[model samples]
Target: MKKLPVNCPSCEKSLVVSQLSCSNCETVISGSYSLPILLQLSSEDQDFIFEFILSSGSLKKIAIKLGKSYPTVRNKLDDIIERISQLQKS
Candidate 1:
Protein backbone atom coordinates (compact mmCIF):
# COMPACT_ATOMS: atom_id res chain seq x y z
CA MET A 1 0.00 0.00 0.00
CA LYS A 2 1.17 3.47 -0.79
CA LYS A 3 1.05 6.25 1.73
CA LEU A 4 -0.87 9.34 0.79
CA PRO A 5 1.11 12.45 0.06
CA VAL A 6 0.39 15.05 2.67
CA ASN A 7 2.14 18.03 1.09
CA CYS A 8 2.18 19.47 -2.40
CA PRO A 9 5.43 19.06 -4.26
CA SER A 10 5.30 22.06 -6.54
CA CYS A 11 4.79 24.77 -3.94
CA GLU A 12 5.37 22.81 -0.75
CA LYS A 13 1.86 23.73 0.30
CA SER A 14 -0.04 21.79 2.93
CA LEU A 15 -2.66 19.41 1.57
CA VAL A 16 -6.06 19.26 3.22
CA VAL A 17 -8.05 16.08 3.08
CA SER A 18 -11.44 16.38 1.48
CA GLN A 19 -12.54 12.77 1.45
CA LEU A 20 -11.80 9.31 2.69
CA SER A 21 -12.27 6.13 0.68
CA CYS A 22 -12.71 2.57 1.72
CA SER A 23 -10.42 0.42 -0.33
CA ASN A 24 -12.44 -2.75 0.11
CA CYS A 25 -15.86 -1.35 -0.62
CA GLU A 26 -14.82 1.50 -2.90
CA THR A 27 -17.06 3.78 -0.90
CA VAL A 28 -16.21 7.45 -0.74
CA ILE A 29 -17.30 10.13 1.68
CA SER A 30 -16.57 13.75 0.94
CA GLY A 31 -17.02 16.90 2.96
CA SER A 32 -15.08 19.45 4.90
CA TYR A 33 -12.40 17.26 6.41
CA SER A 34 -9.75 19.59 7.64
CA LEU A 35 -6.39 18.30 8.79
CA PRO A 36 -5.75 18.73 12.48
CA ILE A 37 -4.56 22.30 12.82
CA LEU A 38 -1.29 21.10 14.27
CA LEU A 39 -0.49 19.24 11.06
CA GLN A 40 -0.29 22.59 9.36
CA LEU A 41 2.58 23.76 11.52
CA SER A 42 6.25 23.65 10.63
CA SER A 43 8.23 20.55 11.67
CA GLU A 44 10.25 22.54 14.22
CA ASP A 45 7.12 23.96 15.76
CA GLN A 46 5.58 20.50 15.87
CA ASP A 47 8.65 19.10 17.63
CA PHE A 48 8.56 21.93 20.14
CA ILE A 49 4.88 21.30 20.77
CA PHE A 50 5.49 17.58 21.24
CA GLU A 51 8.36 18.23 23.66
CA PHE A 52 6.31 20.80 25.50
CA ILE A 53 3.54 18.29 26.02
CA LEU A 54 5.89 15.46 26.87
CA SER A 55 7.67 17.71 29.37
CA SER A 56 4.35 18.38 31.05
CA GLY A 57 4.46 22.02 30.04
CA SER A 58 7.71 22.67 31.91
CA LEU A 59 9.78 25.25 30.08
CA LYS A 60 12.96 24.52 32.01
CA LYS A 61 12.85 20.84 31.25
CA ILE A 62 11.97 21.44 27.64
CA ALA A 63 14.89 23.81 27.28
CA ILE A 64 17.30 21.33 28.81
CA LYS A 65 16.07 18.41 26.75
CA LEU A 66 16.14 20.40 23.53
CA GLY A 67 19.50 21.99 24.38
CA LYS A 68 18.05 25.41 23.71
CA SER A 69 17.89 28.60 25.76
CA TYR A 70 14.87 28.92 28.00
CA PRO A 71 13.77 32.05 26.21
CA THR A 72 13.95 30.32 22.83
CA VAL A 73 11.88 27.40 24.02
CA ARG A 74 9.37 29.73 25.61
CA ASN A 75 9.08 31.76 22.40
CA LYS A 76 8.43 28.62 20.35
CA LEU A 77 5.85 27.40 22.81
CA ASP A 78 4.11 30.76 22.70
CA ASP A 79 4.07 30.67 18.94
CA ILE A 80 2.59 27.17 18.85
CA ILE A 81 -0.05 28.17 21.38
CA GLU A 82 -1.02 31.16 19.29
CA ARG A 83 -1.29 28.98 16.19
CA ILE A 84 -3.42 26.42 18.00
CA SER A 85 -5.73 29.12 19.26
CA GLN A 86 -6.09 30.58 15.81
CA LEU A 87 -6.88 27.17 14.36
CA GLN A 88 -9.54 26.60 17.00
CA LYS A 89 -11.13 29.93 16.16
CA SER A 90 -11.15 29.13 12.47
Candidate 2:
Protein backbone atom coordinates (compact mmCIF):
# COMPACT_ATOMS: atom_id res chain seq x y z
CA MET A 1 0.00 0.00 0.00
CA LYS A 2 1.16 3.49 -0.73
CA LYS A 3 1.86 5.67 2.26
CA LEU A 4 -0.57 8.47 2.95
CA PRO A 5 0.98 11.91 2.78
CA VAL A 6 1.89 13.57 6.05
CA ASN A 7 2.75 16.91 4.50
CA CYS A 8 1.25 19.20 1.90
CA PRO A 9 3.11 19.02 -1.39
CA SER A 10 2.81 22.61 -2.44
CA CYS A 11 3.24 24.25 0.93
CA GLU A 12 5.33 21.59 2.60
CA LYS A 13 3.19 22.00 5.67
CA SER A 14 2.28 19.24 8.07
CA LEU A 15 -1.14 17.66 7.51
CA VAL A 16 -3.71 16.34 9.89
CA VAL A 17 -5.86 13.26 9.54
CA SER A 18 -9.26 14.68 8.78
CA GLN A 19 -11.07 11.50 7.89
CA LEU A 20 -10.81 7.78 8.48
CA SER A 21 -12.69 4.74 7.19
CA CYS A 22 -13.20 1.10 7.97
CA SER A 23 -12.57 -1.21 5.05
CA ASN A 24 -14.62 -4.01 6.58
CA CYS A 25 -17.71 -2.00 7.49
CA GLU A 26 -17.35 0.97 5.12
CA THR A 27 -17.86 3.18 8.09
CA VAL A 28 -16.47 6.73 7.75
CA ILE A 29 -15.51 9.09 10.48
CA SER A 30 -14.34 12.69 10.21
CA GLY A 31 -12.35 14.83 12.56
CA SER A 32 -9.08 16.70 12.89
CA TYR A 33 -6.46 14.51 14.42
CA SER A 34 -2.76 15.25 14.57
CA LEU A 35 -0.46 12.56 13.29
CA PRO A 36 2.18 11.18 15.60
CA ILE A 37 5.50 12.92 15.10
CA LEU A 38 7.01 9.70 13.86
CA LEU A 39 4.44 9.38 11.07
CA GLN A 40 5.43 12.85 9.93
CA LEU A 41 8.86 11.54 8.88
CA SER A 42 9.77 10.71 5.31
CA SER A 43 8.80 7.28 4.02
CA GLU A 44 12.44 6.16 3.85
CA ASP A 45 12.86 7.10 7.47
CA GLN A 46 9.67 5.32 8.35
CA ASP A 47 10.85 2.21 6.56
CA PHE A 48 14.14 2.38 8.38
CA ILE A 49 12.23 2.46 11.65
CA PHE A 50 10.17 -0.54 10.58
CA GLU A 51 13.34 -2.43 9.80
CA PHE A 52 14.79 -1.30 13.09
CA ILE A 53 11.80 -2.80 14.87
CA LEU A 54 12.14 -6.00 12.85
CA SER A 55 15.76 -6.19 13.94
CA SER A 56 14.73 -5.55 17.53
CA GLY A 57 16.51 -2.18 17.32
CA SER A 58 19.84 -3.83 16.68
CA LEU A 59 22.10 -1.40 14.82
CA LYS A 60 24.45 -4.17 13.79
CA LYS A 61 21.64 -6.19 12.30
CA ILE A 62 20.28 -3.17 10.53
CA ALA A 63 23.69 -2.36 9.07
CA ILE A 64 24.15 -5.90 7.79
CA LYS A 65 20.64 -6.03 6.38
CA LEU A 66 21.09 -2.78 4.50
CA GLY A 67 24.60 -3.67 3.32
CA LYS A 68 25.88 -0.55 5.02
CA SER A 69 28.71 -0.09 7.46
CA TYR A 70 27.93 0.08 11.15
CA PRO A 71 29.00 3.72 11.33
CA THR A 72 26.72 4.63 8.46
CA VAL A 73 23.80 2.92 10.09
CA ARG A 74 24.62 4.59 13.38
CA ASN A 75 24.73 7.98 11.70
CA LYS A 76 21.35 7.28 10.13
CA LEU A 77 20.01 6.39 13.55
CA ASP A 78 21.45 9.57 15.02
CA ASP A 79 19.76 11.64 12.35
CA ILE A 80 16.48 9.89 13.05
CA ILE A 81 16.89 10.60 16.74
CA GLU A 82 17.56 14.27 16.06
CA ARG A 83 14.49 14.50 13.86
CA ILE A 84 12.32 12.88 16.50
CA SER A 85 13.59 15.29 19.14
CA GLN A 86 12.76 18.28 16.97
CA LEU A 87 9.34 16.95 16.08
CA GLN A 88 8.39 16.22 19.63
CA LYS A 89 9.18 19.75 20.73
CA SER A 90 6.96 21.30 18.08
Candidate 3:
Protein backbone atom coordinates (compact mmCIF):
# COMPACT_ATOMS: atom_id res chain seq x y z
CA MET A 1 0.00 0.00 0.00
CA LYS A 2 1.09 3.53 -0.69
CA LYS A 3 1.81 5.75 2.27
CA LEU A 4 -0.39 8.76 2.89
CA PRO A 5 1.26 12.08 2.18
CA VAL A 6 1.74 14.41 5.12
CA ASN A 7 2.40 17.61 3.21
CA CYS A 8 0.92 19.57 0.36
CA PRO A 9 2.71 19.13 -2.95
CA SER A 10 2.62 22.74 -4.06
CA CYS A 11 2.69 24.72 -0.84
CA GLU A 12 4.96 22.38 1.12
CA LYS A 13 2.65 22.73 4.10
CA SER A 14 1.39 20.06 6.42
CA LEU A 15 -1.73 18.24 5.26
CA VAL A 16 -4.65 17.04 7.30
CA VAL A 17 -6.87 14.02 7.07
CA SER A 18 -10.16 15.31 5.69
CA GLN A 19 -11.98 12.13 5.00
CA LEU A 20 -12.05 8.51 6.10
CA SER A 21 -14.23 5.53 5.26
CA CYS A 22 -15.07 2.10 6.49
CA SER A 23 -14.16 -0.63 4.01
CA ASN A 24 -16.66 -3.14 5.37
CA CYS A 25 -19.76 -0.98 5.83
CA GLU A 26 -19.10 1.71 3.23
CA THR A 27 -19.58 4.30 5.94
CA VAL A 28 -17.81 7.60 5.43
CA ILE A 29 -16.75 10.46 7.66
CA SER A 30 -15.17 13.81 6.89
CA GLY A 31 -13.38 16.35 8.99
CA SER A 32 -10.14 18.24 9.35
CA TYR A 33 -7.75 16.24 11.51
CA SER A 34 -4.07 16.85 12.08
CA LEU A 35 -1.72 13.95 11.59
CA PRO A 36 -0.12 12.57 14.74
CA ILE A 37 3.35 13.88 15.53
CA LEU A 38 5.02 10.60 14.58
CA LEU A 39 3.08 10.24 11.36
CA GLN A 40 4.11 13.77 10.47
CA LEU A 41 7.69 12.57 10.14
CA SER A 42 9.17 11.54 6.81
CA SER A 43 8.88 7.87 5.90
CA GLU A 44 12.57 7.19 6.37
CA ASP A 45 12.46 8.50 9.91
CA GLN A 46 9.42 6.37 10.62
CA ASP A 47 11.25 3.32 9.37
CA PHE A 48 14.19 4.14 11.62
CA ILE A 49 11.81 4.31 14.57
CA PHE A 50 10.35 0.96 13.63
CA GLU A 51 13.82 -0.52 13.44
CA PHE A 52 14.76 1.00 16.76
CA ILE A 53 11.77 -0.67 18.35
CA LEU A 54 12.54 -3.97 16.66
CA SER A 55 16.09 -3.85 17.98
CA SER A 56 14.78 -3.50 21.50
CA GLY A 57 15.99 0.10 21.67
CA SER A 58 19.60 -0.93 21.28
CA LEU A 59 21.68 1.71 19.54
CA LYS A 60 24.53 -0.72 18.98
CA LYS A 61 22.26 -3.19 17.23
CA ILE A 62 20.73 -0.48 15.09
CA ALA A 63 24.15 0.85 14.16
CA ILE A 64 25.34 -2.63 13.22
CA LYS A 65 22.23 -3.28 11.15
CA LEU A 66 22.62 0.04 9.34
CA GLY A 67 26.40 -0.41 8.98
CA LYS A 68 26.89 2.94 10.68
CA SER A 69 28.93 3.98 13.70
CA TYR A 70 27.17 3.80 17.04
CA PRO A 71 27.59 7.55 17.56
CA THR A 72 26.05 8.24 14.18
CA VAL A 73 23.01 6.16 15.04
CA ARG A 74 22.78 7.84 18.41
CA ASN A 75 22.94 11.29 16.81
CA LYS A 76 20.24 10.37 14.35
CA LEU A 77 18.01 9.16 17.16
CA ASP A 78 18.70 12.35 19.10
CA ASP A 79 17.71 14.43 16.12
CA ILE A 80 14.50 12.49 15.74
CA ILE A 81 13.74 12.98 19.42
CA GLU A 82 14.24 16.73 19.09
CA ARG A 83 12.03 16.86 16.02
CA ILE A 84 9.29 14.98 17.83
CA SER A 85 9.55 17.37 20.78
CA GLN A 86 9.19 20.39 18.50
CA LEU A 87 6.25 18.80 16.71
CA GLN A 88 4.54 18.17 20.04
CA LYS A 89 4.87 21.83 21.07
CA SER A 90 3.43 23.15 17.84
- lDDT against the true structure, each candidate: 0.81, 0.94, 0.94
What's the TM-score of every candidate structure?
0.66, 0.91, 0.93
How many residue pairs collide in each prediction?
Answer: 0, 0, 0
Best by lDDT: 3
Tens-digit per-residue lDDT, 27-61, candidate 1? 99998676777777767687777887899989999
RMSD of each: 3.8, 1.2, 1.0
Cα displacement (angstroms), candidate 1, residue 6, comes to 6.8
Which wins on TM-score, candidate 1 or candidate 3? Answer: 3
- Model 1 poorest ten-residue lDDT run: 1-10
Put down candidate 3 lDDT per residue, 1-90, tens digits, no spaces: 798799899998889999999999999999998999999998989999999999999999999999999999999999999999988887
Task: Look at candidate 2 and tell me the lDDT of residue 85.
Answer: 95
> Which ten contiguous residues of candidate 3 have the minimum total lDDT?
81-90
Question: In lDDT terms, how accurate is model 2?
Answer: 0.94
* Candidate 1: Cα lDDT at 22: 100
The deviation in Å at residue 3 for candidate 1 is 10
Model 1, stretches more than 4 Å misplaced? 1-14, 22-28, 88-90
- The Cα error of candidate 3 at residue 41, in Å, is 0.4
Best by TM-score: 3
